[model samples]
Target chain A: MIPIKKQYRRLRSLLFALSSVIMFFIFWELIALYSPSPYVPDPYSVLKAFITMLTVGDIDGYTLTWHALVSLERVLLGFIVGAATGVPIGMLLGIKPTLKGAVTPIIEPLRFIPPIAWIPLSIVLLIGLWRYIFLIWIGVFFPVLLDTIAGVKRTSITLIQMAKTFGADNKKIIARVIFPSSLPEIMNGLRVGLGVGWMCIVAAEMIGGEPVGLGRLILKYANLLQIDVVIVGMITIGLIGLTLNYFILLLEKRLFKWRVEIRA
Target chain B: MKKAILLESVSKKYEVGSSSLEVIKSLTFDVNENEFVCIVGPSGCGKTTLLRLVSGLEPPTSGRILIFGDPPDPRKQRFGVIFQEDSLLPWRTVIGNVKFGLELQGYKESEHEKIARTYIELVGLQGFENYYPHQISGGMKKRVAIARALAINPDLILMDEPFADLDAQTRSLMQRELLNIWSKLNKTVLFITHNVEEAVFLAQRVFVLTKRPSRVKQIINIDLPYPRARLSPPFISYRERILTAFHEELEGI
Candidate 1:
């Protein structure tokens, strides 16, 4: 049914997208080579350092893999902790109107404040620097919670009516209707919150004294005036973020196969 | 004749900022077993709301609705409803949507599956049982909704413009298909729609309603044969009377 013109346009768009990304990286690599600056390392130098990190271990102080592993641990711990507490709480707020009314007043303002803003308090209250994970958890919790409630609210009124018309009681309606209806939005919130969590990794590492993480690695290179390694760290973080985002997108597109999008 | 559904002076009101909006006010009707009653009303006439009240989905403001002269209970499993939209659960496979009522009625999983399969096959959705609502076409979804309603085998079925949204061709096909099913099963249907031709085609009797806080204006009986031709003299007369009643609402005001 699709016209060949549309098919050709789609091909053009795909090629355009691929070339744009390829060119961006190629340009960055070229500039690093030709530019004469001690601070800025060329693409080849960065690759050498990357290879060195794999084989030679620590370039500045911490090994590249070492920082990656540590950052991975922190993210996992914080994400798990946030989800463990946040999911149930979101469900409660979503399902029980009384719970929402009582809790919304408290959660509303607290949600507006950034998680990184809590760094100063975390240091004061908990063990110094380790509280960064707690801060990341805080950042992720609100979006997931609010979006969950929003998702529950978005459940169609007709669906509730349909269930009830079929002799479904309150419990049956909630269990069968509200729960599934909220799944898509819950996933959306989780993905958005996670992106925030990853971006906040740098903030977490910077606040907490760490020889690990691309964030802290960059800070180390900045002091040494090795801008190429700094760019490498930035690229590394960007790649990791892209990887995580892609996985979330993949899960969304895969698991919710029932999604029939309104194609433009 | 067996009185299948009875609405005894049933009334429903909505309070909006010190103003009371009465959608159904002391409205009463009785549908005999195997009878087809069509409620024709303009938008916001609470045609759908009345059906919901009869189905036990919504309680009346001051009166009670009864299935077979007793207070209506969804647990009795006597009423089936098809909304304007199919309202099929997007997450559920077509068969799952059809089996919903049976499952609610406490039918065992195996028996439920058997019934669902039979009805989906009857409604021309055998191959689509495994397909989700989003995967199917709108007409197919409507058929599934009809199948879902019929799967319960209720004494009385309430339908609110079930095919109003479909293209004319599909709507005509559905009307014929529904009549075939209704004729065979002898199911009592209280159908609501604004389409005069549809009201004539589907119902044994059409109760036309006035616009804005409507009450029944006329109950025109169609005594023609099954699969009544729209071009018949009596059928056109009935349509004219209903249309005149509707026009009176606009012209008089």
Candidate 2:
């Protein structure tokens, strides 16, 4: 059971957090009231638009939930494919420095070319869903690969030496020691890659005539000068990003329960 | 007694930039079966390098190291090594880390848990089986390292200053615990440390080495019985003899 003082302290912090959020909305509402600009919709109008889009059968071509689900599918598929391929190649590069030295020069220049910049080439070479998947994959691949390589390189020499002394062959050492030790860094890379992949899917949807994604809906409404609908789209993206990040953090905490903060 | 390990004039030289820095020079020693031997030397006198050479983690620049009358090879011979650092895997629990060596050796899946549990209890970590290394104290982590080494049932154990990081009280307590474990297992152990008192307290014989281009300076046999008294005259005399020999090496440098 929590102590009474500790419970009171937690309640106080919660109240403060709630007040801060309330204060932000109040400030936005006041600004909207004084200015009365079409560009800056009041919070009530944005909330109303959000609900209406959720219930209505058509926002652009499909309901808001359908648009979100389509974008989620694209992001998940691209992220999985990118991670599945990137992690193994990264591990290979990490173990074989000579091979890494040969391949790095080519990858270094290509990775710098942003996923959005690949849109023209993707459009020319691919059609429909492949285009979206290609962009998202490009966005997700490099971070995971680079981070995995860095993680492998950072594995403790002492741990490897200890494993060897215990009669572990090279294969066993790599499978048991190197892989598990690099997990924290790999998870961090996945989190970063997920964010980048989500952004790429939204940007790709905006450019392509997807007709069923959140980005497409945002573009359609913005073109018609419906500021409230645009605001609704932005809020949806933010909420989804926040939710996905929260899940990643929860997974990290669960997997890395062994990590503890050292106090001075 | 059968020879558990023999080092014939083993030398280690590391190339730094263009110059070669000799670490161990013409060092030779032998440990008999089930003997607890400690190597004491001035800091940076290649004690760890010697342990690594015997463990076959690194080859000696010159001379030979043998285990049971054959040249040592890590893949073919079973040797457990405890490093100076708390080398427990941060991702695994106490039981998982203890079972690491057995798992690597491809022990039967059914036997792994029983063996790991036995060693965990042997190390007095019965209730901490599920706790991660980070959650345990430094002394406890060292115990886990010992348990991990013992779980494999290796032919010999090489330890490199395994308790140098603990406080004096904890270090003394671990020393006693280690002695108890060593006596019960009857395994050959090659322990390395710079602490003269610790070396005198733990080993049946202490091999003292000179600084820098290190070689055995003196070999002092400790004939004291088990549960040696630190305050007793014989214990103090043994400590003094090792300290004097060690200081002489320091002065020569």
Candidate 3:
């Protein structure tokens, strides 16, 4: 059980967060009232637009949930594809020092080019779904690869030697020792990769001007001066990103029960 | 008295960047079946390197090593190794870590579980079989490593300073428990340590090694009986002898 003092501290922190959010909304409302421009819609107007978009649908006859689903599909598809390719290649390179060394020079330059920078090339060369996937792939691939390599390299020499003394061959050693031990790091890589993929979603949808995505809806509404709807789109993206990261954290907790709990 | 391990002029040289560093030079010894031998030396005297060579984890630069009659081939001749550091897989439960060797040997889950449980019980960790390495104390972790090594039913067991990290009280308790287990199992053990008292307490014969480019300086037979009293005059003399050898090596350095 948590001590009373610690619990009280936690409660105090929660209250502080709630008060800060209230303060932000109040400040925004004051700004909207004084501003001459129509672009800065207050928090209440954004909330009102959000409910209407969810229930009554937007002007294009599609609901906010539909836009969210489209964005989610792109993110999930691209994330899965990127992980499938990245993990195996990462494991191969991680196990073979010579292969990693040879590949490093070529990959080092490419890794520096972020997902957004690939936009111009993707828009020109890729067609339809591939363009979105390509952009998100570029975002997700490197972190997962690098983390997996680090995890494998960080495998304890003591454990490997112990395994060898038990008469374990290379394949058995890798399967029984290397893979399971490296999982915590791999999960961490996946979480970071998913975050990058979600960040790239806005630019990815912007590439082809996709008709149904949150990114597209935000831009489309902004063009018509519907600042309230644009704010709703932005809020949805933030909430979804938070939800995705929370989901990964929960999964990590369940899978790695042996890991020391780091409750910061 | 069958020879379980034989080392003939065993030497290990590690090439560091440009220059070659010799860690072990001409270590010749034989460990008989069911005998417990300890290699005690000053720190960085290549006690670990010698163990690595005997376990076939590394090849000797110019000497021959044999397990039983054949060359030290880890894949062909099974050996149990316990490292100085905690090598227990944090992700595995006590039983799972013990079952690791059986799993690699292609034993079915059902069969391996029974074998693993026996060793876990042998190490007095039966009730804590489900506990992870992190959940246990340091002493328990060492026991789990022991159970893991012994579960494989290896011909020889090589331990490198297995209790070096334990508290003094726990270390003494563990030593007694280890002796109990060793007598019961009748397994050959080649243990290494830097502590003179630990060598005197555990080993039937203590092989002292000199400083860098280490070689056997003296092999002292512990003629003392089991449950050997640390405060006993014989035990004190044994400790003094090894300590004096260590001091001589330091002085030479």
Candidate 4:
């Protein structure tokens, strides 16, 4: 409650974080040195491999940054395409009875089939790079679509009636009230969809090796028995995923501050 | 007095399995300008159904409703409604919730800002303009809902058990504040409640309904003086008459 206590708490948190990093690195490096096999490299050696991947361009051609960039571009493009259509489709289905009934049956079944199942069909239909993009798009679209619809449906009937009584037309009610009210759920869908998209991309990249990506790099190292390099690639993937999720959360906080429940 | 709201032979029905259940039966009433009309009845007596019909939220199965000499056009007639729930927009500040109807009615930004500020102060939320609905107490939220309706300056205000969720202390305060607001604004109010004392306290005329196929059991005019004393002989007599009628109506149901 007091200013002094708040400052002390912040300093304590900073110290705790610093000690955790030091202790974790020390234990990891110490364990790797006396290990029985080459699979578990020392933390220092893994760091060296990470540096080589970044500075000298790992494997044959591309650098670590190159793989991360390529992966980022694919996911971002697929997410944009998926959300651009998914949100409106979801909203339309939720609001209109006839549309919901007709379309929901189709969506209900299609959503259950894993995006991986369409790999062969996608390869048969589309050319090289587009296949991977299509798989990622499919992975993201359904979760986002379903969640958006659920959110719109959950809007309170009283709020709708209130808007209607106050002279809000169908268009104004949808655009102004329902859409903003549904944002928290739509954002939730997008978050889940992105995770599915990430998983789909990794599976596709490893199997197909169609482009420069972390998934492809990890696969390349795994095949060559460079387990440490593979581990490095996987860790980078995790870190990048964390960074992307953090950005989404930041955007959510800024735009939908109302969704954050007031402490009072 | 100028007539603002009128219903003629209005009734509503809903299909129930193999039979049709009629809710409102040949109900007709007129709300004069600046008059406060309270509709009180036993539970499931279609008090809510009548309010919805008047506000054009639900259409009567048979009869027509005319507001201001024309069929009620929701777009042209911006009515304010306070439900049992506060119905405050969760994302908005106290002022934002108050300004919602004004914004939808195309009131200019500056004009609404002034009006919202004035009304927020009126509802005793002067320092809570930036507080979101979730941050406010239940009583505070109710006040904001009241302020929002007032800011819109609707020709009619329909309230359905608006104080039902509030504590007795808060409900009494809200009643006094509501009467003060009614005296100042003079909007035709159609308030629905089941509390006998509440109906007797607030209304010019209390329209009681029968159980199912709810028709007007009786429309009792409160001849008790304004600023009514609760212990007065006339007030108690009117309440006793309504309760006795309610008892007979319940027995029939």
Q: Top TM-score: which candidate number? A: 3
Candidate 4 residue-wise lDDT, A1-264, digit = tens: 669989999999999999999999889877787778767777777888899999997767789999888887887778888898789998998889698998777888988888778888888898766777787888889988988998899888888888888888899889877887888889989988887787676766754645478888888888888877887888898888787777887787777766545231
Which wins on TM-score, candidate 3 or candidate 4?
A: 3
TM-score of the first chain alone, every candidate: 0.81, 0.90, 0.92, 0.85
Please report how far candidate 4 places residue B8 from its true position, in Å.
1.5
Local accuracy of candidate 3 as per-residue lDDT tens digits, B1-253: 4489888898889999999999998888888899999998889899888888888888899988888888887878778888889898889988888888877756687889889999989999879989988889999999998888888788888999999999999999999999998999999999999988999999999999989899889999999999999999999999999899878998887
RMSD, model 1, all Cα superposed? Answer: 3.6
Q: Can you tell me the CAPRI class of model 1?
A: medium
What DockQ class does candidate 2 belong to? medium
Off by over 4 Å in 3: A1-11
Model 3 compared with the native: what TM-score? 0.95
Per-residue lDDT of model 1, residues A170-199, tens digit only: 889877888788888888888887877777
Supply the global lDDT for candidate 3: 0.89
Residue-wise lDDT of candidate 2 within B113-161, one digit each (tens)?
9999999999999999999888899999999999999998989998999
Cα-based lDDT at residue A85, candidate 4? 77
DockQ of 4: 0.65
